[model samples]
Target: MASAAEQLAANMNFQAFAKATELHKRIWFTLIAMVVYRLGCFIPIPGIDIAAFSQAFQGQAGGILGMFNMFSGGAVERMAVFALNVMPYISASIIVQLLGSIYPPWEKLRKEGGEAGRKQLNQYTRYLTVVLALFQSFGIAVSLSSSPGIVDNPGPFFIISTVVILTGGTMFLMWLGEQITSRGVGNGVSLIIFAGIVAVLPRYVIQAFELTRTGGMNGGVLFMIVVLAVAVTVAIVFMERSQRRLLVQYPKRQVGNRMFGGDTSFLPLKINTSGVIPPIFASSLLLLPATVMGFAASGNLPAWAESWLPGMVGQLQHGQPLFMVLYGALIVFFCFFYTSVVFNPEDTAENLRKYGGFLPGIRPGKRTAEYLDYVLTRLTVIGAAYIAAVCLLPEALIGFAGVQFYLGGTSILIVVSVTMDTVTQIQSHLLAHQYEGLIKKSKLRGGRGR
Candidate 1:
């Protein structure tokens, strides 16, 4: 049977949406913000030779740069101001989150300081973002300088300007994302990334079709890829929605002849508690060494280094056995690690016990914690395997098929997950609007009765 909320959602119509003025405002704000981001993707940075850079970028388009370009909405390809996109911000946020668990002071703030602490940590993340952006932008400028014809004026001025422009662009994006989160719909950073990917998705699709038409790719292979993509999307949705519910019973209590409690609830645990983090982390780690080696090999390295770097990079290519194995192993490792960080069985057990709730036929304290940990461990195993399969299979197939587009499992996961989150937020807003309408109607009736 469908829940009341689900039924209400099903019955929601255009009329109800029309009445949600706040939601309308938020939607408009998000759209405008995304438009601004896309526009920035086209505005190239200063002092870069556009034609030279484009030619050089195309040569390395099948490698890591291609993946980054896709995420940046072709900003990287254009060497745009937003070439860094929100990646530095994302890395900073991840670093902050991991530190919050390990660092004693930050962990205290995270656990006890509440809202104020969160703001402080966000400030820390922003600072870290600026640092990382500066570092990355400097590296990029140096790399471009090394590649002849890419930098128009290869000097200190050029490097300084490149670093400032790219870092400033990243900071601006970070601020824009914060605005979206406060006044718009969905998470600002995620929506920005989502917009970037969706914006270029059509071109990728058209390219696929063009490849099929030009006889560069077999028609049957194209069809298989399309089918595979759709299948993976379906699997993503299903697994994302799947949950394991643990029943918790609250015993009845009597106080002054008033009975309370005596209720049952199920704690819902998602099949994939870690979400898209594992795949993203795994891919980033796996690609970093390859990217560095590729860049080094292109530069004026010594004969020994040059000879070995290219071979190492070749071995680490997408479909290679070493790459695939490392990718899968990293994904599995991060899945378990992140899950452990996010969900603490002992804390959950303590909370349940404090609230006088207990799992049926189980003790309410330490034993409950053990049971929860055991269940979560089993769930993580399945979750890890599912994530590995989803990410690796399509990647291997695409690499083998010589597909140029970087439409891998991570992209699919991000698109599906972000879409689902945005839709859910919209529905919640609609529900809130409906509830407000009901309250207004009831008050009007009461006023008239009086």
Candidate 2:
């Protein structure tokens, strides 16, 4: 039998949506924000020769540049203002979060302090974003200048301008994302990325068809790719939704003449508590090598150094054994690292003990914490393997088929996860709207009875 909430959700229709005026506003705001983001992807920064840059980019397109372009919705390909995207912000956030776990001051602020502390940490993240953006944009500027004819003026002026424009563009995107999170539906940063990936999806699909028409790819391979994509997506959804429920019991107690407590509940822990962070962090680290090599290739290096750079880049190329091994290892490492950062079994156990709750077969406090940790460790191991498999499969397909579709495993994960989350938020709003209508009806009935 369907629960009341489930039945109510099933019965929801256009009428309820039409009544959700706030949801409409949020949806509109999100659309407009995404439009603005897409527009920025085309707004090229000053001092770049488009033709020369395009030619140079084509050579490096199969490497890090290609991945970044996919994430930025072709912003990097166009040498647009948003070419940097929100990567600097993401890097800064990761650093801050890692510090919050190990650094004493940050740890205290994160746990002991509340909203104000969160705001402070956000400010710190923004400041660090500016620094990283400046550094990365400067390096990119130098790299562009090194490429023959890529920069109109290969001087200090051009470099400064590129750095400033790119940095400013990134900061603007960060601000835009914050606004969307506050005033619209879904996570601002993630939605920005989501919008970027989805915008380019149609073009990739068309490219696949074009490849088939030109006999560039075998038809059977394409079919297999499609099937594999579907299978992986299904697996992602299932694993993401899977959780372990731990039963907790509260002993009956008496307060005054009334009985209280004596409740039974289950504490739900997701199999993949780290979500997409592990894969994102892993990819970012793996891609860093390509970016570094680009800078080195552009520089005047010794003969030995020049010879070694090519081999290093080749070894780190997508689908190579070394690349896959490192990618999977990093994913596994981050899975456990991030899971520990986000969830403290000791804290949870302490909270449960304070509330007079205990696990069915385990004592409260230390024993409970140990039990939770043991279960979580096992789940993380499984989750790490799942994430590694999903992410690496696309790399293998790309290598085997010699087709470059930007909708890789990471892209699919982000798209599906964000879409699910947004849909859930919409349903919650619709449920709230129904509850409000019920309250109004009940109030009128009570007044009539009086």
CA lDDT, every model vs. true structure: 0.86, 0.86
Per-residue alpha-carbon lDDT of model 1 for 1-450, expressed as tens digits?
997677778879999899899999999999999999999999998888899999988866776567678778999889999998888887787788889989999999887888999999999999999998998899888889778888877988988999999999999999999999899989888888788888888888899899889988899889988899999999999998998999999999999989999999999988899988887666555555666677787777897787677777776766667778888998999899889878999999999999999999889999999999999999999899888989888779977887766677777887898899899899999998887887899999999999
Poorly placed runs, candidate 2 (over 4 Å): 1-4, 404-406
Mind giving the per-residue lDDT tens digits that candidate 2 earns over 238-282?
A: 998999999999999999999999999899999999888787777
Q: In candidate 1, list every pair of residues with a backbone clash.
A: none
Point out the worst 10-residue segment of candidate 2 by lDDT. Answer: 399-408
Number of clashes in every candidate structure? 0, 0
Question: In terms of TM-score, which candidate is strongest?
Answer: 2
Q: Candidate 2 — number of clashing residue pairs?
A: 0
Residue 420 of candidate 2: its Cα lDDT? 79
